[model samples]
Target: MTQPLPTRDTIVDFIEGIFLRRGAESYLGEAVSMAQHMLQAAACAERDGAPAAMVAAALLHDLGHYTNEMPDDVLMEGTNNYHEEAGANFLARFFPAEVVEPIRQHVATKRYLCAVDPAYFQRLSDASVYTLELQGGPMSGAEVAAFRANPYLEACVRVRHWDDEGKDPERAHPPFSHYRPLLASLVTS
Candidate 1:
């Protein structure tokens, strides 16, 4: 049986009291807020002509990090495990497969693409590079071969790109408050 959805007030309180605490300075870097980062990723996905589900996935990809404090070891290891997986797991109860799967597989996709596409890893931020090593580095030839064989490769790649682009602070996107409507819709439906 499906679990009951969280109330809109509950979600808002969580986002405010937990996720977006300190006005984005604490969670985000010198420039952007967590909300801004998420919106930028969603915009990037939209610009790249991704599907609605994928865009939503991009928008909510980091939800877990804000909602729960993840382990530093897991964050550093970069092993197909991290905030993305955590976020996906949390979202699965409320969202459909199309949304959850993309979030779940985003990190793996990033790793796979970095392994196969030489140019991909080159563009990663210094932070991402350091974390990649902990996450087990790039996939092996055998791993890449197997990963590329998956049907969701394209979506994963798009999500990964957006994931990177979302880091910039200069990008224009809606505040986290904007998603309240969408969140409410999901909860009520």
Candidate 2:
């Protein structure tokens, strides 16, 4: 039998299991561990006054990486594990569509941004750039139009920008307990 979907409390337990055990976990190529990277992203969203659901999405955007068991060096091995898609699908079982869709499309938002803004690519971290090529380089004109048609594009972009910012190892942020209520509020069962 399949496991029951996570509730607010158990989700926190899941977070602790998947993220907290690691030591200084590197994100793709970030100096911080996976937990730190996620916390940083959620902190940015909170600082910018994002809605609670968006903040939750930021915090859990890479749930797929943990769930999929993708290695930290997946990018180095020249694979696009499509962690964004994996993450979104997994989260859908627990979150509302509003929350899941942005996680689903955040990586595509990166590609769309690169095709539209020359400077965006310059700001990408080395690991991000490496993954970009794996994600299919920049989007073409047709691809941009297709991406624009997605209703979740704005939210996805916001999460993507915060994903970029979340790489910092030294930023101050609240602990996981601070977000528990928000997760409970957003989860629909």
Candidate 3:
């Protein structure tokens, strides 16, 4: 049998370690840290009246960057680092469906928007564009059709919007530490 995943405290510790070692340089420029970005996004989601679960999902959406080092080629190729997959996989062990599903579906949501919404991709920053190419080029028609069929489309859209707008620290949600108590309770229970 496989070993059990780390406890929630361990996951939190892992997050702290990422904050200390990676800082923000990996995600964007040094001007804004990953932790800061996540918090800002979470805050924005919360302020916009998103449910607590979605706000939490927004805050932790990029958790994969902290847990694993994405290859630069993957970053450049525009292929999904499976960040959504990774983040969802990790969080699902501890968080409820309300939290995990949105994180899992965020990337698909982005693709769906890009495919149908004419102005959607244009708003992405240069870096985002570069990454998008590597993440598998605009969604194919089949992918779009698949996305349209999903029930989680609304949550995914909200999460994607929070994600794109979240890079700005000033406008995103509160710090990750703010969710620590809630995480701890979930893990221990």
Candidate 4:
């Protein structure tokens, strides 16, 4: 049988368990561990003075990597893990649209940036470059137009930037507990 869902009061603990258990894994061949990458992304959002919900989005953006059923080598083996959708859908259970939508759209935002700015493509790490192909490469003209129309476009882009910047292995951010209150504040009952 499936496990019971976390209630509003216990959701933070449930999420914290995820980080503690799955966060130590490699972040898709990035220099940092998964937890480090996510914490660092949240740090970037916090440093940039993003709204609390955006900061939460940046923190939890890659949660699908933890929640998905795919093996670690899924991307390397030529499969699209679709982590963005998995993560956003999971977060939708407990978060507002402002928080979940950015996570959902972050991968597309990467594609959007690649289509709009050639230089952005050069900045992606090797793994990201590989995944970009799996993610449908850059946006086509119509795709770009649809992406532009998303109300969360700017937020998605900002989260993408943080996702890129968050791979620095040496950078340190506060632990998950530091953001627990912020997360709790945004959790829907």
User: For model 1, where is the 10-residue window of minimal lDDT?
Assistant: 1-10
Candidate 3 lDDT score relative to the true structure:
0.69
Q: How would you order the candidates by lDDT, starting with the best?
A: 4, 2, 3, 1
Between candidates 1 and 2, the lDDT winner = 2
lDDT at residue 137 of model 4 (Cα atoms): 97
lDDT of 2 by residue, 48-116 (tens): 999988899999888777643433343233334577766776667678877899898888889999999
Q: Model 1, stretches more than 4 Å misplaced?
A: 1-19, 22-31, 67-81, 180-189
Which residue pairs collide in model 1, if any? 77-134, 77-135, 78-135, 79-135
Instruction: Look at candidate 4 and tell me the lDDT of residue 55.
Output: 95
The clash count of every prediction, one per candidate, is: 4, 1, 15, 0
Error of 3 at 182 (Å): 4.2
Q: What does candidate 1's lDDT look like per residue over 105-166, in tens digits?
A: 87778788788888998898887787788777899999898987877777778888998898
For residues 1-189, write the lDDT of model 3, one tens digit per residue: 112345655866655555556655546642457777777777778779987777778877888664444323323433444777776766776777777888888766776787888799999767777777777767899999988887767777888887888676455445567777655554523
Task: Tell me the deviation in Å of residue 182 in model 1.
Answer: 4.6
Q: Looking at model 1, how many pairs of residues clash?
A: 4
Cα RMSD (angstroms) for every candidate in the order listed: 5.5, 5.0, 5.4, 4.5
lDDT of 4 at 68: 44
Q: CA lDDT of each candidate?
A: 0.68, 0.79, 0.69, 0.86
